[model samples]
Target: MLALDFINIGNGDCILIREMEGTRQKFALMVDFGHDCLVRDDHPGELDPRSQRIYAGDFLRELGVTHLDVALATHFHRDHIGGLGRVLDAVTIDRFYTTYLPPENAPELDPFHPDNNLPKAARSALLCLQIFTEALQSHPGRIKQFELVPGTETISLQLTPDLKMDILCGEPALYRRQKEIYDAAFNGERNGYELVRWAKSMNVCSLRQRLYYHGKEIVLGGDAYAHVWETVNLTPCDILKVPHHASFDSTS
Candidate 1:
């Protein structure tokens, strides 16, 4: 059986997936954590600042996971990847997965639109993440990064013989055209982390995943823009984590 847990991490979502059983095999995959940047909560009660925010060390200890074979950061947004830094601090990761990064100061404005009309809040978040990415690149022991070419790789969990996972996104490209733009901005430093020039712009969130093997599938859709999700080939799973805080018109 698959031991899956999807906690309502405030506006953002956090998913925990585990499989296998006894006999020297066990594993758990924790998805994103809650974000403090939300308007309301379904639960009507007092607010707790300490609640929902999944700091890396605390989250791992809470789940009793000192390390993870796989850590997937679907995209580079605070809500989706906000807790990644902290999580890395607590757990040793075997593999890290993420989509492409835009330029540092060079942003490809929404061409179709006249001014790339973006909300003030989103713009602020993107700026924060840029700094975060810089840090990610500088971290002494950041988890190794990998390109998840669809139909080229699979994510499986073998605790022993109870659960497994399979996932694919960008099989297809979330933003194929933007790749060139993001590439141009890279200066290729020794740190080797992808860098982007910041000109002030953003797009739909980008994140996708499905866990299964012994009868369980958890789908995590990060804030992939329409360009990303619309083209990607995705098979719906038992548990579907919505993208962009269930936003009305981010990525459907």
Candidate 2:
């Protein structure tokens, strides 16, 4: 079996590909689908994150990607999940991974709105949110919505040999109720312009591995703080799927 190809999906994103071993060949695996809004991708403006799905779909149809083995969502943010709906719409999902921050039901929260940050406008946002909500609500007895709890787990595949992976950090939730508590020391204070940076900081770090292959040993460090990286025991790797999209600035 040839090693999977990490297709440069652009803007610090990629799609891991393998020959379709559906039954006679192989299986195809993919990571986060990158962005939603049509921006100028590395290849061309015509190729947005949607292209990732198209690429995957076309590969599957020709290569036989009838079912997806794994789909890991780094966080709840848009860039990571925006292009996921199309892929799901096309193929069957076997295992889904995500950092589950339980839905905070605020009367102000328009659950109909997919994105908690941006103003409601995009159809993909709404549709994706619907898909997630339905999945969480109508889960089978054994299905689980994985959350990033405090610990390290080796994400080993059945077909791999000598690849090791683990969950590194945690993304805690915030509460806004009768009493408004602002813990600037822990969560960090935002000076107005730093809101995006601040939001980017609260994501958990995840690891990835290729296993005895060329780009075999890799680490996908998600939006983890410096302390998180410093305190943890990381061995290092050939490549790393950065946390929070490579805006690598932490107050050390």
Best by lDDT: 1
Candidate 2, residues 26-56, lDDT tens digits: the string is 5445665554443533346454334543333
Instruction: Please list the residue runs of candidate 1 whose C-alpha ends up more than 4 Å from where it truly belongs after superposition.
Output: 20-25, 33-56, 101-128, 142-145, 148-164, 170-174, 181-205, 224-236, 250-252
Return the lDDT, model 1, position 69.
Answer: 65
Show the lowest summed lDDT stretch of 10 residues, model 1: 189-198
- Candidate lDDT scores, in order, read 0.52, 0.43
Task: Name the best candidate (by TM-score).
Answer: 1
- Measured against the true structure, the TM-scores of the candidates, in listed sequence, are 0.62, 0.55
Error of 2 at 227 (Å): 4.2
Candidate 1, position 107, lDDT? 41
Clashing pairs in 2: 20-26, 21-25, 21-26, 21-27, 205-222, 221-243, 222-243, 223-243
